[model samples]
Target: MSDSNRTDFTNPSTFILLGIPGLEEDHLWISLPFCIMYATAVLGNFTILFIVKMEESLQEPMYYFLCMLSVTDLVLCTSILPKMLSIFWFNSREIDFLACFTQMYFVHSFSKIESGILVAMAFDRYVAICHPLRHSTILTNPLVAKIGLAVVLRGVILTPPTILLARQWPYCQTNIIPHTYCEHMAVVKLACADTHISNYYGLFSLCFVTGPDVFFIAVSYTQILRVIFSLPTKDAQLKAFGTCGSHFCAILAFYIPGLFSLLTYRFGQNVALYFHVLLANVYLLVAPTLNPIIYGLRTRQIRNRVLHLFTHKET
Candidate 1:
């Protein structure tokens, strides 16, 4: 409503989000699960933060990174979910042009930051397992803080250029975005100007976020695997690998949906449009919902703290 209503415009005063193309009638019904996902993400991520804050013993480099992941999950879920539900339930689909671009930037920014945190987590696990004697010395509070800063800076720096490119383009063309949120490409496609630069930059942003992060993760795991195999006993190896179970699960939950959604749009031309939109939405929302669940179930200390917190509350 705050958007200036000007019909003849470079960028239209507002853009309309279709929520999910080809599934208009199902929006009401679909809100059920989406609402539940948002709730679960909120509660789960908050619980993770709470447990990490309350239990001093659990406050280490690892939990610090987990806390970063939880915070990212919180932002990722919140950035798009409320607007999505509003669109679904209230039919309020108008987002201002600047706001839409801002949403896209933050969505991608926090998303990449999440990936960076996972990479940092992989490094943390590798250090802890591969160099047990020097784990504390290697991953001190200052180093962890620096890594956190670097992760934030990575997202902040990498995600903006694409959105900035998108922003400069004229939008005298249709302002209807077919997806729920302001996805970078979806919005870019709405531009009347030639978007070769935006499109190419978008691809660059994708690779820039995924490529090196994946490389570091792969290297960390490879070294970790080597260290585990070199151990004297199978029990020791299993225990060493076991320490990374939660992080591994968290990584899978975050990346699988993301890569699936990304590739689906790029290669799955036969897939339904609504399926792509739905998958994109899920790709955005599911990690936050699942990250805490993965950590809560798989990480022993946080699990124990969570149980203790609830049990203490009950008594």
Candidate 2:
């Protein structure tokens, strides 16, 4: 028998995820905290959706963007939580090749979609604040729908090429993935075939996705700031920026760590495995958890609508 084929028979065709290597011994300690974070993330984003939908007062471009953001957060959390919880709660590490690719695809797809949506939101805010006289005309319902369609198309198209490139590579080597979820780069690295194409796509993906999105967001905020500063009334300036504070914070939380991780990994920085895993979890959790809190706290109308719903339900 060939020595290479001598892998453990029971775990063939799939790999067990080691899951944040050094902390495996203390897995129990983290389960409760992760569970709390997951629940809060889900419930918080769901509340945002509920508040947006039930409140007619929020039927505007900004609220529409907020609702889309909430939905993206829900999908993003779902993509990571089940796999992570399974590893933590049951110590189950078996994920089939197909399943792993599927997870990677959705994770990548939704993340890209979220980035696009944030860009769209920035545009909405820019128009609303910087060009108030023409905001309603430019950001009509049809225009928003078209932007949403473009976002979906961008994500759907960009994701498949990465998945196909990863799958085409031969994986005659060991399949042990180091983390809980199926990270594309990590999975591609396991392949026995040449991964130069995957690496190229990886770099291109970062530049193409992150570069333009960040540029648009920065420009939008700059214009927003310009308009706010031009206002003579302090109350007007405060109110204008107030509308964007939550989104800006959410964007910072989502983008900075992600870029840091990407740059560090690409440059061969020896980041701790746990740091990567923890940051992934935080990036997924923090945006969702904060989206609801930021919007709900900043926007009085949403707060009142949620309270009214609860009060009506209780009575």
Candidate 3:
């Protein structure tokens, strides 16, 4: 092959992640907060899982869904933060191409699964409130198992194409990804070949997964609100809203930063890269860190059980 042609098809064996541009000197300092967030997320989710498992009364549909959510959060944070901390604290930013793509797949897959779980939880609240008599009949253990299976299958089916398409390209351009971790678009941007298909498909996949889930969740909440308002007494309304408050907070925590980051990436061409990267990291880290905290404070059963776990002493 001619030198020019050889250059056109060249692909690097590894890529470097630029932890955070212009803040390289503060990598260690930046890692502190990330480390704390990861630890909190891990501990919080595990505690939720433990409490749900040990407390027989907590084995209802809502807590079952919470278990799914906790597992997804655990997988999501574990998929990214460990490598990210390595990059920040040690300047160990070199990632093999295969490893980078593997990380991207897990990050996106777990994110989709988490979104689906939120939708399921919203539906659980909907059934419990709108059709109280039938909620038990409707959200049976078998149904919950099916929902979990479907969520995993959706993530498994939708995410691999993006990675496969990316692998087909020749990454002859700079392999320095300007982000804390391997994200789908970030890695694709490093390819020299035409990326329109991959880029458009990524957007399509986001719409395909999150768009429908968010729409259904909104619909569920809308019906829930209508029911709450129609109740005869103010106390009843307060009680209904209380039941959903934690899930509402969780939805906000999960989607707000995520949507903001997506919008910034698509439209904020002149925005600083660091701002974009920071928001992206927040999208992944903040929700998991806050989810258990939200539930612990707002969920009476979980809060009581968690307290009992800590305070109980053996005779």
- Report the candidate with higher TM-score, 2 versus 3: 3
Sort order, TM-score high to low: 3, 2, 1
**Candidate 1 lDDT over residue span 231-260, tens digit each:** 999898788677666567667777877877
Per residue, candidate 3 scores C-alpha lDDT tens digits across 92-190 of 999998998899888888888999999998999899899999999999999999998999899888889988998888888578899988887777777
Candidate lDDT values, in order: 0.86, 0.82, 0.86
2 or 3: which has the higher lDDT?
A: 3
TM-score computed on alpha carbons, candidate 1: 0.92
**TM-score of every candidate:** 0.92, 0.92, 0.94
Candidate 2 clashes between residue pairs 3 or more apart in a chain or in different chains: none
Candidate maximizing TM-score: 3
